[model samples]
Target: MNLLLVVAAVLAYTVSAQQCSTPRVRSEWSQLTQEQKGLYVRAIAALAAKPASNQYANPDIMGWHDFVITHAREAYWAHGNAQFYPYHRAMMWQFEQAMIATGIWPSNMGVPYFDWPAMSQNWWTSDLFTEQYLGNMNSNDPDHCVLTGPFAKGKYQVAFDVDNRRAITSGDTTCLRRNAVQAAGDDATAIANSMNAGSFAQFTSSTSGSYYDTTNYHSTGHFIFGGEGGDMSNASVSPNDPIFWLHHGYVDKYWWRWQNQCEQFLYDYSGTLMSANDPNGNGIDAKASADQYTASWPFKVQQLLNTQGGDPLCYTYSKSAGDIPLAPLTCPPVVKPSVAPTTAPPATATGGAAATSASRQGSQLDDKWLYTALNLLVKQKPLGSWGNAPKTGATAAGGIQAADAGDVVVFGRRDLNETESFNGTLEVASATVQADETITGTIAATIQATATVMATTSAAVSEPIKKEQNAYIETINPDNSTTISYTLSNNTIEIPAGFTVYSVMPISATAINETSGKPKRFFPEIPKLEYVQHAEAPVNVEVGSHPCHLAYPILLPESYIESMGMNYNKYFNAHVRSKMQIDAFNADNCTTMFSPSSMMNFNSL
Candidate 1:
């Protein structure tokens, strides 16, 4: 009995130690009381007015601008990679502390999120655009400068344009600019797709999107809120906008929701530190860990993972309209779609141009295609031997290539700032075509390539193309929570349900936002692509179809990967491609460009 009492005392002490005394609740903008909202805004103004603290260490900057500079300096490390979530989580907590320091808000008052999807359909008409809230949309302004509201032009002086490094260092000042626009990527389906990811590596990749991919909710949210020429659009200096805190608060809440789904996910952190767009010459694509320090923040990544774990992060997100669990769906086996067989057309010499259709089957391509057609001519080898090309003339091994492909005109999807559709071109002087059977036995056709063929293709075909079926079906629940379902790995995922069902959905209603009573004039007129209409994943394994290709050297050999005690199949499958293509290439006797054995040259890649 004495021993039991001693053990009970220790347990009680542990429980007491772990309990948080002043846990805060981060709410949606609509959820905040009028007084709370006023205080929140006042705190922001007060914080902006205060001088930068010595701890922040930015010379001649306001307290608020210090956060902006911190974010800008560490932007490269914070975005397009695994550090995205944890780094922002830490930044959010620090911003909260700074706001609390203003004395206008209560010590435990947490940041509020703009539940973007909830009001996304009618964001322009929402109370968020009022002078009392974030600011006016300023849709009519040529420069997209905020014209009225608390953050309108001249209301607050921006320290510098983060886009220009010199401007940042020189501390150039300007009025806030917000070219607010809507994006298909910032919808309920996109949010659901990201939240449904079963693993952290998948979650991070899907949620953040790759450096080359900007269709995901994270990138879209920024683009929509940041508008065309706004502070929020710039990843590095996004903190310049006060709304950045709220946006990140929503992101943290999403992470928190993902964390609560399972015990394993709470501290689950694994992904490469190097993003696809590696800017810093970081040779090591190091695996990310919770133990690592967050970008620009003093806290460790693990500490930032937990919201109620105290000291730095001690807040709970108020349950809002779209709050839902990450449902672990077990889908039924997939029935492979039968490809209709087509007889090869007879080679005819009756026309000025040969009409041919080449289809690419997979996402990753072998790098051997980097060689010029002259190289193939010198070797007198069929183009199919080099890469996944056809064995014939203009019809063979010919299709649009990605902009990054050597010496070719860069086209298709580009970074947000890029305006040019065509960059340059590759000129192949003269090439003789060889076909199995031709009208004249061995037809010698002279081919001259000038412009990027990819440029002439439709946007859907030029950029990453998504099969029509993978799109999410969003059902608005009677309770206001969204039931978004999508297919991943043959598993049809309907969040909150234990089972799965296959679905092919049309794009969600784009007109829902327009139905609101707001006059048409109130909305922003900024033009942008509808990513919702073109969400991408695994590519169709049609030769000459896709532009994005992974060089062979990047893939670790199956034997070597297995030797390290990792699943080689999982590593390969982890790439954003369909399982069918990955499976086909992994098999022996496959005669595709993705020859794993021949391509595995780690020694001299």
Candidate 2:
């Protein structure tokens, strides 16, 4: 039995090498040599030059636009649904094939990714928006056309209109446009929130919560670059922008990172065909399966799970700006059972408020004690709320301490400034199971915090400075086990006028148990928390500067509007006035605002 298990482990790990043999590595955009970039640019140009023949293709539209059209057609089904990750992964593979088919680039020329976190707050100055790369972020033209770069105006005619619904005829030509802005979720904080998600459901919700989830990199990545006139912002025709591939490449990398957390995650799949609230979804299965096919694609969700192992996905991500080294593709080593062994009860999860304990030796505390007390407090109190002082004789719902401890453990929110008054008697620390199996005993701990911000705008003394803050705690246990606790503190953020602030707070915890030499996760149910606070001084709008057109019904479909608790016709007038970019819309005094379209507008449908 032991030999058989060892053989199975070796077989599973070697499958990738046997199947792919030589996996192509996708590099960061800047990592590409000048010759590589030139080849890629030429390949894209070739795709854009050929006439499309697909059923969805428009008159005189290039082969490249075929992808944009397909993306638009499947937008409703592919996004805010269970297929978001898998579907995009398939699309990436397909585009790579198309690029190779163009005969301008080599098969090894995998699409490069833009690391949002690396260029987070300073995206405008990125090389991606330069003459040598994609193009200048914004255009002087009123239509916001790209006047430089390889895909400059008159070089590559854009096929779609502002809403990305209408395509031009043979005689008419439109230049690719850009209305750039600082995107949300481009910072490290947002990336941490995504990487720390415990389950696929939690991952999807935090990464792409419908169209309205600005905190997610998906929506913001498109919107900030796509701003009203830009093709990248519109969900349907976003692929029209060459930058779309790079953006999704990073997204794919993040999902890959999440899956590497455990062996189970590679097969982990769940969530409905579409958002449950979407009327079109009609309540399909909430749990997705590996056998399931991605929307509008022939590949199964299972095939897209692993970049190297997934069928037709034979590329690996090279160590780049916003990525980590790939985890080994080997199965865990098999361990033979001992003749006489002690077992620890399996860890169970429950949710609510968690408590924190500080040792008299400053920030150093006991790992087992902290985990037990926090888990205990969570079961009794509500999350994100302060725990009141516990009574002297009171005990938590599951009983105060583990079976071994004689003295009761009393804990709650104690005043930090209060004087310490503990008798010198040493109280024994205990957990539910043996010290080796389960956490037990009072062990030393060290807590460290690192902060990553989005944009920091310092104004004159009279004006308020715009600030966004996101924080998550990573605790290194005495046993070297790590617990990554995400705290979405229940506090309202205030954004001053003329600044954009994006913040995400983790309302729960996701911890990994690696002592056994295999990854095990403790995931408690963490509810989705949306906190959006925007404060701005109202400005008078000169409506005619930009056309006063309403968001098309197709763009803001009835089902989507209903999900957001908004009326189709009245939504713009009622909600957008206060939220729209006052500076961008006004054009004349719109220096503060990044672009003409509001974040909500970009997400409409």
Give one clash count per candidate, in the order shown. 12, 4
lDDT of 2 at 548: 33
List per-prediction Cα lDDT, in the order shown: 0.44, 0.45
**What TM-score quantifies how close candidate 1 is to the native fold?**
0.49
Listed per candidate, the RMSD to the true structure in angstroms reads: 26.5, 24.0
lDDT of 1 by residue, 446-477 (tens): 12111122122212232332222223433433
Instruction: Please give the distance, in angstroms, between residue 197's alpha carbon in candidate 1 and its true position after superposition.
Output: 2.4
Off by over 4 Å in 2: 1-18, 55-62, 160-172, 182-185, 206-215, 275-287, 324-605
Query: Model 1 has how many clashing residue pairs?
Result: 12
How well is each residue in 1-605 modelled by candidate 2, as lDDT tens digits?
A: 13332222222222222355577788888798888887888888888877653421011122676676557545644664567788888778767766766777786657788776544545666677888878888877776777899888788866433222423223235577677764323433224434555566666653322221213355557767767656676565678788999889988887887777766666667664432211112223334556555654434566677677734467778776544222234343333222222232322212111000000001112232233223322322111101122212211211122222011121211111211121111111111222232212221110001111111121123333222223433333333233333444332222222221111212211111111111111222223333222343234422223343111111233333432222233323322332342222232333322222332222221
Task: Judging by lDDT against the true structure, name the best candidate.
Answer: 2
- Error at 534, model 1, angstroms: 13
